[model samples]
Target: MDWIQGFLVFLSGICALLFLFRKFFFKSKLANKKGCDHNCDCH
Candidate 1:
């Protein structure tokens, strides 16, 4: 039971780190790009 709780804590930490990295790095990159790949006339 103790080991199971520890494993869950470790997984949560990893997920938090990944979420922060994506928020800071990937979101900015997408905003700076000057193109739209989605449907509709964005140009």
Candidate 2:
């Protein structure tokens, strides 16, 4: 049970790190588009 809990904690930490990186360090191309509300097949 301890090992299982540790594994879950590790996974949660990884997920949180990835989320933070994506939120702060990475930017989606579509998000930078102007006057585009839906998928415009721009790329």
Candidate 3:
């Protein structure tokens, strides 16, 4: 029972960290100009 509780706490910490990372670092739009397409010259 103690081990299970510890595992759950660790999992919760990892989930919280992932959520914060995504919230701060995830971008919703592309920064590059000219857009994305097979014919686009931008790399």
Report the lDDT tens digits of candidate 3 across residue range 1-43: 9999999999999999999888644332332443655654445
**Which residue pairs in candidate 3 have backbone atoms (N, alpha carbon, C) closer than 3 angstroms, thus clashing?**
none
lDDT scores in order: 0.74, 0.71, 0.68
Cα lDDT for residue 11, model 2? 100
**Considering lDDT, which of the candidate structures 2 and 3 is the better prediction for this target?**
2
| Candidate 2 structure quality by residue, lDDT tens digits, 10-39 | 999999999988875434554565444575
Residue pairs that clash (backbone atoms under 3 angstroms), model 2: none
Query: What is the C-alpha lDDT profile of model 1 across 1-43, one tens digit per residue?
Result: 9999999999999999999998877655665573545632333
What's the candidate order when arranged by decreasing lDDT?
A: 1, 2, 3
What is residue 42's positional error in candidate 3, in angstroms? Answer: 26
User: What local lDDT score does residue 1 receive in model 1, on the 0 to 100 scale?
Assistant: 100
Which is the better candidate, 1 or 2, if ranked by TM-score? 1
Candidate 1, poorest ten consecutive residues by summed lDDT: 34-43
Give the range of the ten consecutive residues with the poorest summed lDDT in model 2: 34-43
Error of 2 at 9 (Å): 0.3
* lDDT comparing candidate 3 with the true structure: 0.68
Winner on TM-score between 1 and 3 is 1
